[model samples]
Target: MPSLRSIRSRIRSVKNTRQITKAMEMVASAKMRKAQQRVLDTRPYAEKIYELMHRIASREKAWSSPFFETRPVQTIGVLLVSTDRGLCGAINANLFRSLVRFMKERPGVRFEFVTIGRKGRDFIRRSGFNLTGVIQGVKDRGTIEEILPATQLVIEEFSEKKNWQEAWIFYTQFESIMSQKPRHEKLLPIDPEVLTGSGNPPNGHSGEYLYEPDRRDILDVLIPRYFETVIFQRVLENFASEYSARMVAMKNATANAKEVIYGLTLTYNKLRQANITKEISEISSGAEAISQG
Candidate 1:
């Protein structure tokens, strides 16, 4: 049993913590909404480009682009998108776990990493993996230009055949406010099946289209744009997931702090009542003794 003074101090501390957590929860909620809207706005464009790219690649098999060339598996390039900050529940941990699982699945394969956030960079560095590129301190509402460097790094490495046969991206896909799943997708080799596998296009039609110049010419431009759009969209999805996870984590923290405050208040009241009762008893005993004397 803590003293009344100590219990009062604890209650005050918990109340202060609750206030901070509540404030963080509100901030995260607002950011999450904006991030969600950004993802929603970009998803259609991403899907349409993907469908167009798939259509082109499937039709133009005779075209020879470096992006569609498949080479022997030797070294793999991985772009990991993570949150810059912490307190986002198990989101970062889940991504790391997914990375570990990936490594386990492909044993003895060398992985070159390009990290988009401080957390992923630190993880890659601490794990002693080959970190080829890093892009940190991206804003909450980051632009595509902010991620262009990493995207280019992956593109140049893969296209130039710099020991990178396959390129992949790991990110948290924002399914809903309560659910964010850690996912990875193969970025290079321009797999038309994988592109079309992600469901129908924005118009809900996957029919063939007429290219203006030629299929090869369109692919030469569309392939790179498709890569950039996919990477940018993954970053946006990661942003939404980060905010959603943070908002939920802060909400839980705020609730736990409130519970602590409530418990501490109850203890404080009990101790104060006990102290008052003891003091009254002592006063009555002293008065009785003085009267007898």
Candidate 2:
């Protein structure tokens, strides 16, 4: 058994750790609330844009946008979004695991990756994947400009640079404080059903939307904005998921530290009482002996 003094020191250490975890928990909670709100506020607009893009995509050759051009997917672009730091429970680990599964599912398919955080960049490097672009230090509330590099990489791959035929983005989606879902969302060569959250088209000829000037004109204007909206919403969703995971992780840590402190304090108290009782017993014995003498 450890000495009482040593146990006291351990109790103090655990208390300090608990304090730190408690503070971090509070910070993560605050950030999670803001991030969740941003996601909720922007998701509808992003979804509508997604639905509109898919609707236009149904026009096929009738629509003149290069983004609508379909080709054999010789190369695929992947935009992997993850947090720069850890302490977020299994959030990043689960994402990385899913990414591995995605890669495994497409054995021969060459991938060009654009990473939006330090963790993703590291994974790309370690996994020996081609790193097309990297976006680091993005805030919880990232602006369109800040996320342009990533979206641009996807556009460049399929259009400007013309290296890849299709693109997808992977990120954890915030469902609730306790549930963050990792999603693999196709970004380009638009999957109509996926875009609109519909499992399948109702018929061979899907319903259409009317345009003011023409389909070409509207798509030309909306295509770039669609890219921006998709990327922005992904980033917001990523932020919210990251913060929620972190808050929950920190809360669990604080709770665990508290349990450790309680156990240590209990041990310390028991040992101290034993030592005090031993000293009193020894002193009393000595007094009785002295009186007898």
Candidate 3:
């Protein structure tokens, strides 16, 4: 059994840790609320752009954009997004696991990865994956311009490289506070169905509209903008998912800390009682010895 002084010191240390975890839990809760609101506000716009893009692609037979052009797969580009910090539970691990599975399946094809956070970059580097670009410190509220440089570079690299056929983005999709799932989505050769969210054509809107500035001309600008929208929404969604995961993880940590403190308190009390009982017995024995003498 440990001494009373040692138990007291341990109890104090655990209490301090509990306090820190509580603080982190509160901070994560506050951030999650803000992030959730931003995600809700942006979803409609992203959905609409996706719908419109899909509609355009489906309506015109000859109308085509480079983004919609599907070619043979040789070299692939993967944009992996994850948080810089841990303690957000399995968010980064889940992403890395998915990436590992994806790379494993396509062993013959070369992979050029673009990592959007410190965790993702460190992961691929440590695993000896070919990293093409690294973007770190992306703000919780990132702008299109912030991601534009990286997006352009990926596009340019794909255009310049003959073997590179497609680009994919692996990220966590935020469904609810309790449910964030790692998703594998193609970022290049933009699938019209993917943008619209409805892989099938909506019967009501298919034949109603006529093109204004020629279908090809409109697609030239819309396709790239559509791609940008996808990237923007993804970053926002990624931020919201991070907050939600962190909030849940911290809450669990705080609960676990409380449990630890409770167990320690019980032990401390038991130890103190034992010490007091031993002292009383010793005192009584001394008195009895003196009385007997």
**lDDT for each of the candidates?**
0.86, 0.85, 0.78
**C-alpha lDDT of residue 208 in model 1:** 60
Relative to the unseen true structure, what is the Cα RMSD of model 3? 2.3
Candidate 1 on 1-293: residue-level lDDT in tens? Answer: 66778888888888888898899999999999999999999999987886666666665566677777677878989999998999999999999999999988998889999999889999999999999989877776878788778878887898864669899999999999899999998887767777557664334544566778986787778777888888999999999999999999999999999888888777778888888999999999999999999
The sequence of per-residue lDDT tens digits that candidate 3 reaches over residues 109-183 is: 889888887888999999998988988667876677787766776777766554468888888888988989988
Best-to-worst order by TM-score is 2, 1, 3
Off by over 4 Å in 3: 60-64, 160-163, 192-199, 202-209
Model 2, backbone clash pairs (residues 3+ apart or across chains), number: 0
TM-score of each: 0.92, 0.92, 0.91
Model 1: weakest 10-residue lDDT segment is 199-208
Off by over 4 Å in 1: 195-210
Query: Best to worst by lDDT, what's the order?
Result: 1, 2, 3
